[model samples]
Target: MSQPVVVVENLVKVYQKNIRAVDNISFYVYPGEIFGLIGPNGAGKTTTLRIIATVLQPTQGRVLVYGYDVAKDAAKVRRIISYLPEDAGAYKYLTGLEFLELVAKLYTKDPKKIEEFIEIGIKLSGLGDRLNDKVKTYSKGMLRRLLVAKTLMVKPKVAILDEPTSGLDVVNAVHVRESIKRFAKDVGGTVILSSHNMLEVEYLCDRVAIIHKGRILVVGKPRELMERFEASNLEEVFVKLVWGA
Candidate 1:
């Protein structure tokens, strides 16, 4: 098998010196895999992703992205990864095109590369002429699609997304989910995302880790987890594990 694209070893995080937001959790994600971190609100999912993205320092253990330690090689990690926070927002005053262009410029100074990335962003967005309109006018779903497009446009080696489909109607949510899966397959890049939606995770993730109360409850292929738990789907498995239903 190929080397893992991401590895988390005994990762931990603490807040206010006493509250442990993440506790000694470990997992590995492979290249081109859509790995899901599924949990309820305040389950430490966001904290884990933040640590891996180099936005937060781990209180213990380590995270390696392609063998570069997140803590010691943050600049290299940041260069290869794109992160989308749970409540990510674009500049309201900037047009969708302008926002994408700005992000592209930050990653590359080559004019050809910038234009190439912008074009990729536009294609991924599927916004057509609306790409010219200011982002403040976009609906919640449209804004999310735009964000997703921008996140993947640069073709980062890894994408860490916290709740990529948080608040959207079914159609938009499905579109965004498909876009994520397609991006991973087409670009051969790894994707790690956290989501509370079990159905979405079941549909999109190649493997999933169930987290609760700052620890990983289980990790496996969704179908394998369901079979092992004698459940019909991920939702049932989640309920059985978390609630003992």
Candidate 2:
């Protein structure tokens, strides 16, 4: 495999009351691969992802992005990666165009690139007349589309998406998943996805690690994990791991 784009070594995080949201967990995501951290809600997936994204400092251990330590080299990591949280809320007051412009300004100062990104985002989102409207008035699906577009605008070396399709209709969910796949393939970037949607994980991830209660229980290709557990789908494998068959 090529150089790992994302690496986690016994990463751990503790909250205000010393609740260990993420225990000692380790993994590596290779270049151009889609890696999924599959687990139930409150399974520490979000906390782990937040630490990797550098939004929150890890209580212990390390997360490195493209050889840059997330803690010590946060600036370099930020430049090379984009992360979208599960509850990624936009400035509601900003129009979709304005939002995109703001995002573009952060990583790309080129007006032309910003304009091009906005054009592509508008077209890709199929938001039509709504692009001029403030995001506060947009529907959930529309908001998701815009957020995804905003993330893609960076064209980073790695993209971390937390439940990217959490609340979309079947059609929109498929659209977002396909868009993520295409973005990774086109840019040859790595994507780390945390999702409870088992089918989505099976379809999108090149390899998956089943996480539960802050620790990984299993890691392998979806099919291999399924076959190992004598299951027919990812949901079944998840149940087996979480409930102990």
Candidate 3:
């Protein structure tokens, strides 16, 4: 639909030990949709996201963002995309508001736009007066929320997020999830994220690809896959595909 905002075809990645980290997988992400690459740790989900974000080169195949090749037109792809890695850390010494303001300045020279970004970041973060506190004083959940705000506040057309809610408690994860949804719906940004959390995928993604050992076993809406597999939930569908039969 709408010419597919992101496309990955016959993607492959290999390590020095001849490990095929990603093996000829393919998928498409439509504009303004939340798409998820779902799998456990080391399933090559992060590798795939890195390729789309233009951070890692694929050993084989191609990735395109808004018709720009990730390898051939990396600069053009990077112009419209933002990437947030799983282990991203905030500047510990800076106050949360200061960190957000810093990112806003880096992304734009226009003062009005910079102010707009910081405003959006503050609302997305939902940190209130605590944003005045140094990042070093923040809890794990608080820091993660701030990081999420920074990533989406850039207003990138495409956001590549690796484990967006990883390691957060339930309340924090829910907040982060709502922020992601707002980015796609209110900000009109396309999102492609990786996570092992089946419930998160089910609740957050419009469609999903089930990945394991660098391969995609299935791709569809959560409810569609559930009905197709005759399962009660996405996790049950995953278990049937990866372990059953």
Candidate 4:
């Protein structure tokens, strides 16, 4: 494989009283690929993502974003990464357009692209009529669509989305998945997503890492993994692999 855009080597993270939330796990994500970190709740998915996003420091081992050490070169890492956490807070008082404009300002002085982004997003998200309204009034699906737009507009080298489609209805979730695929292809960037949705991972990710108890149980293409375990789907494989069923 090509040099990994994201690399983790023996990564470990501990919480209060040194409880190892992430325990000596390692993985690599190549460019232009959709990689999923699949796991149950409290399985360390978010913690691991936070560390890779440079929001949290690893207690042991190392994480690198395109060879920039996350610890020593976080500012550079942040420049090339757009991270959307599971419950990312929004400025509820700002209009959707205003919110995106603020995000654009963080990366560039030109608001022209922000305008373009708003136009494209409002159309794709079917939120044009609501774009002028405060984000506080947006529904869950609407919020999801807006955040997807925000992440795409940044044009980062890697887009890390934690549970990007957590609360959307089926149609909205499908739309979000398509948008994610397009965003990665457009920039030739790596997309790493963490989700418990097996069907979503099977359909969206090029490959997945199954995490349990803060450790990786398996990593492979969804089909390959299912076949290896003599299963019919990712969910079945997950049960067999994690539950010894």
Instruction: Go through the candidates in order and give each one's C-alpha lDDT.
Output: 0.94, 0.88, 0.93, 0.88
Model 4 over residues 39-60: C-alpha lDDT tens digits?
A: 8898899999999899999999
Candidate 1 residue-wise lDDT, 1-245, digit = tens: 78898999999999895999999999999989999999888889999999999999999998999999999999999999999999999999999999999999999999999999999899888888999999999999999999999999999999999999998899889889988988988898899999989999999999999999999999999999999999999999999889951
Candidate numbers, best TM-score first, in rank order: 1, 3, 2, 4
Tell me the tens digit of each residue's lDDT in model 2 across 1-245. 67777889999888998898998999989988999999988889999888878899988998999889989999899998889999998999999989888888888778888787777666556678898999999989999988887887677788899999998999889878878988887777789999989999999999999899999888889999999999999999999899982
Off by over 4 Å in 2: none
Give the C-alpha miss distance for residue 140 in model 4, angstroms: 1.1
Q: Tell me, what's the RMSD of every candidate?
A: 1.1, 1.4, 1.1, 1.6
- Report the C-alpha displacement of residue 215, candidate 2, in angstroms: 0.3
The alpha-carbon deviation from the true structure for residue 54 of candidate 2, after best TM-score superposition, in angstroms, is 0.6
Q: Which digits, one per residue and each the tens of the lDDT, describe model 3 over residues 157-242?
A: 99999999999999999999999999999989999998889999999999999998899999999999999999999999999988
Better of 1 and 4 by lDDT: 1
Error of 1 at 186 (Å): 0.9
TM-score of 3: 0.97
Give per-residue lDDT, candidate 3, residue 97. 98
Candidate closer to the true structure by lDDT (higher is better), 3 or 4: 3
- Cα displacement (Å) at residue 123, model 2: 3.5
Error of 3 at 230 (Å): 0.4
Tell me how far the alpha carbon of residue 232 in candidate 3 is from the true structure, in angstroms, after superposition: 0.7
Model 4 spans with C-alpha error above 4 angstroms: 111-124
Clashes of each: 0, 0, 0, 0
